[model samples]
Target: MTGLLVKNYGIKKAAKLSGVSEYTLRAWERRYSIIIPFRSESNRRLYSEYDINKLKLLRKLTERGIQISNLSSLSINDLKGLLNRVDSEIISTDEKYLQLYDIASVDKTINDSLEAIKNFNEKKLLLILHRAYKKSNFLEFVENVLFPVMVKIGYQWKSGLLRIAHEHFTSAVIVKFVLKISSEFEIKNKAPKIVITSPDGQHHDFGAIIGDSLAASEGWKSTYLGVSLSAEDIATAVNQTNSHCIFLSIIYPNDNPRMEAQLLELSKSIHDDVVIIAGGNAVTGYKDILTNINAHIVKTPKHFRDTLKSIRNQIRIDKRENYEKKYL
Candidate 1:
């Protein structure tokens, strides 16, 4: 489908619209020919509306782990087609790969957990996860087995291969583990206190627990205020905790028409000093709204950690500068 016809946009506007840096855009054009921009007489680069949409789609697909090098030559329709297919590398239902793959021993851990879920044995599932945690580092378990297992479980549920009870059981066990681990390793004096929770209508809360765990691991005092909270309640919790950042976790079927309104209200109610972020499966649907309201969207635990660290570093810099100005 053709995007809207608009005036030719310069490189800066194109990068902002496409969510690609100007340097990256130039690099992609030179190396991959992803979206070649038109050049003016003075050598300024210009992009059309169609080019902008294509670049945005490329960014989204690349974020999902598709290599831009492989996708650069394809049309937008081809990219969409590939995305529509089940990502075989990720949430594939292929029995051969699911039951037999032995890379890093992570596949076995994931398959074992899935089997325990199938048998409706919560204890067994938790045992497998605990064993995996014992065998691998926290980040390894999170990135390799835990996160992939959740994605596979969701895919199975939506495909009618599993029931809601299975998802609930797994979520309950995982959240318990996340909280226990976070508590075990928390630094009492950690700065940039972070508050995580699901806003009203979002029944899933595992994402919040995961955020709390990661934030704690990064030496942040992370507090999880359970799920299904109204805007006023969330704001109250943040205010009470004197949180430096608030993370809103959203789950699938995020058909909450009131979500944007709720976010806007919460943003307005909270102190401007606090940073707001949204994450989880349903975050894509609210990206535009989040950006409009000055809220950040993080897609992975690593991304979340990096964002917090950047903020913490900036705070440190500001404090050092203030101290120097006062005394040195």
Candidate 2:
């Protein structure tokens, strides 16, 4: 009666329950001789509930790079003992697996936004849009798909398929999302600082917030001054913070000339060691304006990553040289 409680599950059902592919399950059973299942009278492999639970644990361990050969020698009791010992240390690994499921479910909400935007359904659209924007790595989701969806929603609103209230609601949701994400990452050290901010008249600060988050994630000491700071204020912030880099975001192309002039003035006011990095749609048509200034121009998030890596490397090299001179 106790054994009967462990109902036999077929391979497909085991795969579904354990979140491992059927091919991988077969490989584990055949190649590694792990989790040998019972055979039915018809000679088909059938896994009991106990065996399925064991397989789930095995899959979790294997994903974390525990050698399969080592696992093959362990009995069910032995595996359970190992899991009991290591489970606390491996919580983050387990969380990653759970996050995969959460990410897939959140992505469905994004897909719903696409459909709602296509149908011009403001109510459904706003709900789904808010859900997707709250997901972890939402900035990537926004840059890749949600941005285009927003453009479509805007076009629909202009053509009268959607109301102005719908557009305002969506923008407010996005602003909150940006704020939430930026606040999640904090400056933890006193490394050479980078101050990122929006230029004068530039109310849009999402790009700057995203850049700050990226910097924080990469362990950069960055001060985000948020939106609507004048060029003089930004230069003063840099001087006061002793920041090595000033990243100015220009979200609209029409503001490039003014932004360029402001940045030029700021660069002149700052010390020669400080670097100015200009980016976003505002620099789209005015690449030439950046030529006279000592600045690095980054156009996208990927470019920003590469540029940040270079800056960090240079900082390291400079520090190493200084250390050699002082200690050696």
Alpha-carbon lDDT, every model: 0.76, 0.66
lDDT of 1 at 57: 71
TM-score of each: 0.67, 0.56
- In the range 215-237, model 2's lDDT, one tens digit per residue, is 76667788889886888999999
**Residue 284 local lDDT, model 1:** 70
Q: Candidate 1 residues 1-328, lDDT tens each?
A: 3444443999877765565655568768999988877788998888898888788778656656578898978988887777666243444223322443344246677788889988888889878888888987776677677777877787789999999988888888888877777778858674778888998899877888888888888888877888889999999989998888888888754678999899889987877657787888778777777865656567666767777886676566656766877999
TM-score of 2: 0.56
Quote the positional error of residue 267 for candidate 1 in Å: 1.5
Give the range of the ten consecutive residues with the poorest summed lDDT in model 2. 91-100
**Candidate no. 1 TM-score:** 0.67
